[model samples]
Target: MDANGHVQPYIINKNMGKPMADFAPELPKKNADGVPIVEPTDEQKYMFDADGWLLIPNVLSEGEVEEMREWVKRLHFDPESLPDHERTILAGPTQRLIDHPVVMGMLNEFTANPALSSQECYGFSLGTCGYWYRTAPNRRTEGLKEARAFKPHNGNGLYRLPGDVHFYNSFPGKSFCPHMRVVWELNPVKYKQGGTLLVSGSHKAVYTAPDEIQDPDSDVWTTYECEPGSLLFFAEATTHSAHPWTNEENDRIAVPTLYNQVDGGFAEALKPDEKLLESMPPLRRTLFRDRYVANNVVGADFKRLWRV
Candidate 1:
């Protein structure tokens, strides 16, 4: 208490840079040459970058869908009939999705540790393989256009602390999101009937969500209508939730899986069963590789996913 003998409050925070500015995110539709050249994922990149989500219609085949349905139903309803290892979302056929090329190709930008991927060490990790089945509740009353709309959660806001992987940052021709979800519906999601609910562009929100965006009752939220086997990719930063299965005709059967950067962990994700791990082939096994690439704890760079 020398000199002035006064007190001042102390505050500490990140000084990453100057204050951030919000801007329009829509990419250019056309170029100087009229219609510009587009790659297979260019459209997807645009949609996902702008809205944080996109649906690839009908990725699984009819037979594949049916097979999955059989397994899912048997596992859910008649678990005793199948072995314990087959009781998981990663059971047999679904295991192929652990390293699906479509997911790897599309989400590589979002979840891959680029340097690690370049080293061919399988840069992405599978967070969870989920088979979600939901049915409407009993005792339905008057006409309901939208009831039981899913609650919104997990959006990336500017005030988040450092070391947060469930975040989104984008630049021209590039976007970064370390955590993403891929939802594959084995049953149809009809319009306003029920599906995954999302706020179109909330992944890049710079401020807290407004009342309208937060309320499922508000029409500001949106959902999709797709055939069975339709797939969707969305960043973890995007606020999303699942609508109830209003269509009692067929119960909703969706396999929504989360993927992430191999070296990071978000949401306290669980590891797949040991039996499931042992049964996988080399490539699929990579999705669940132990996370220790920086210091070469598990397998160093230039190594297989399953290291002894």
Candidate 2:
């Protein structure tokens, strides 16, 4: 327990041997032959540079969205049917979102950071991704005080940077963000019906958000009241919070994806089981490769030790 006695979570692991890779050394500053594996257009680059967030609207058709909405329920009901890897393949109607074209392009630029000539991160890879559903008419927010409607998390606060390196801590043009976030809204998120809330431009802010912005009811925070097929993309450094759902008409289904630089830290422990990998096309399987180990096998210029 902390000094305040509030409940906190911690993990204790006995000291093992040295880590398999030391990621502290700066990457090469430039690679003349280094071309981005995925590319974002000029417009996308501008929007993200100006706001730290971008909304790509209606990338999925109505039919595709419906299929994914149903898939969410099926997956939730029987998660064991598919190995963790195949749960979100990049092919087929429901799985197409695993690497939607526009989304990939944007994530590619953010995770690859061509501005630095790909030095910060060689390329982008999946860190973790998951689906969320808020059933309609659910009273998860019934007892909460209006002031507590949303809870904020992440970002540098009060002019002091966050200790976590992957928490979108850099300014707009620094090293490519260690983490890039993408959220696909499979249901309409109407204003105040509760969607993700973000402090617009806060990813680059060195100061804590003011009281007004933190208030759940305050308009100071930006909330995307978007359509079912819209996508929200943001850097991990952006201060963000979950806005509790108050929608009584329909359930809100969202898939939040976290992509990291090929060399960035990842907290997830699950790797794709062999059966899942063998079943995927080479292109799709590439997303699941263990960055360091896979690089060595692929004859990449830079490879790190996966296990000594």
Question: Which of the numbered candidates is closest to the native, going by highest lDDT?
Answer: 1
List, residue by residue over 23-140, the lDDT tens digit for candidate 2.
2222222221232233455677777755677887787899888888878766666667865665653323554565566665665445642211223333456777777777544444
Tell me the RMSD of model 1 versus the true structure.
13.0
Off by over 4 Å in 2: 1-39, 78-92, 113-122, 138-149, 157-163, 167-175, 291-300, 303-308
> Among all windows of ten consecutive residues in candidate 2, which has the lowest summed lDDT?
24-33
CA lDDT, every model vs. true structure: 0.65, 0.59
Best by TM-score: 1
lDDT of 1 by residue, 149-238 (tens): 566787864245768766786655457677788888889888766788888888887777777866666776888889998889988788
What TM-score would each prediction reach against the true structure? 0.76, 0.70
The window of 10 residues in a row where model 1 has the poorest summed lDDT is 20-29
Over 4 Å off, model 1 = 1-40, 118-120, 139-149, 157-159, 268-270, 295-308
